[model samples]
Target: MSQSTYTVQGMTCGHCVQSVTEEVGALSGVSHVEVDLPTGLVTITSDSDLSEADVRTAVTEAGYQLAS
Candidate 1:
């Protein structure tokens, strides 16, 4: 499995986490998602390496932005 961590902006609560999780988790090969609310960190586990663009798109679709 492959794992990557990213920082996200505009996430302040459980609902935010859920939204991001749902969106990123829907990406192909994604196995798990963990969001750390306090730090705005999102960790994704996948079957293969995920493209940064794909993750950014997923995060955007979830109403958040990946920290640049």
Candidate 2:
């Protein structure tokens, strides 16, 4: 499995974390997700080879911005 970390922005509370986490976790190959709302840090675990762009897109679609 491959793992990656993304710095997401605009996560102000638990609900934001849950929103991002659920969106990311729903993606194919995304086995797990850990989101730290205070730091806007998002970690993802996937068995398939998911690209960084895919991760970024997922975050974007979840109404958040991802650090470049």
Candidate 3:
């Protein structure tokens, strides 16, 4: 398995965490997703390493942005 952590901006509550988790978890090969609301950290585990573009798009679809 491959895992990566990303900082996401604009998440404020449990709903935000759920939204991000759902979106990112939907990506192909993604097996797990964990969000730390206080830290804006999202950790993703997958069958393979995920592309940044894919993660960015997922975050955007969840109504958030990935920290640059």
Candidate 4:
């Protein structure tokens, strides 16, 4: 599996983490997702490397922004 960690912005609570987790976890080949609400860090475990655009879109869909 491949792992990638991204910092997200605008996450404030458990709901934020849930939203991010749901969206990112829906990605193809993603096996796991962990969201750290305090640090706005999202760790994704997947079968293959995910693209930035895909991750960005997923974050946006979850009502957040992926830190640049």
List the global CA lDDT of all models. Answer: 0.98, 0.88, 0.98, 0.96
Q: Which ranges of candidate 3 are over 4 A from the true structure?
A: none
lDDT of 1 at 48: 99
- lDDT (Cα, tens digit) per residue for candidate 4, span 1-68: 99999999999989989999999999999999999888999999999999989999999999999998
Q: Give the lowest summed-lDDT range of ten residues in model 1.
A: 8-17
lDDT of 1: 0.98
Please identify model 2 stretches exceeding 4 Å from their true place. Answer: none
**Residue 36 in candidate 2, Cα distance off native in Å:** 1.0
- TM-score of each candidate structure, all chains considered together: 0.98, 0.91, 0.98, 0.98
For model 3, residues 2-43, the per-residue Cα lDDT tens digits are: 999999999999999999999999999999999999999999
After superposition, the stretches of candidate 1 with alpha carbons farther than 4 Å from their true spots are: none
Winner on TM-score between 3 and 4 is 3
Candidate 2 — what's its lDDT? 0.88
Instruction: Arrange candidates, best TM-score first.
Output: 3, 1, 4, 2
Q: Please give the RMSD of candidate 1 to the true structure.
A: 0.4
Worst 10 residues of 2 by lDDT: 48-57
lDDT of 2 by residue, 1-68 (tens): 98888899998888889889988998999999999878898889899878878888888888999987
How much does each candidate deviate from the true structure in C-alpha RMSD? 0.4, 0.9, 0.4, 0.5
Can you give the lDDT of residue 51 in candidate 2? 84
| lDDT per residue (tens digit) for residues 43-67 in model 1 | 9999999999999999999999999
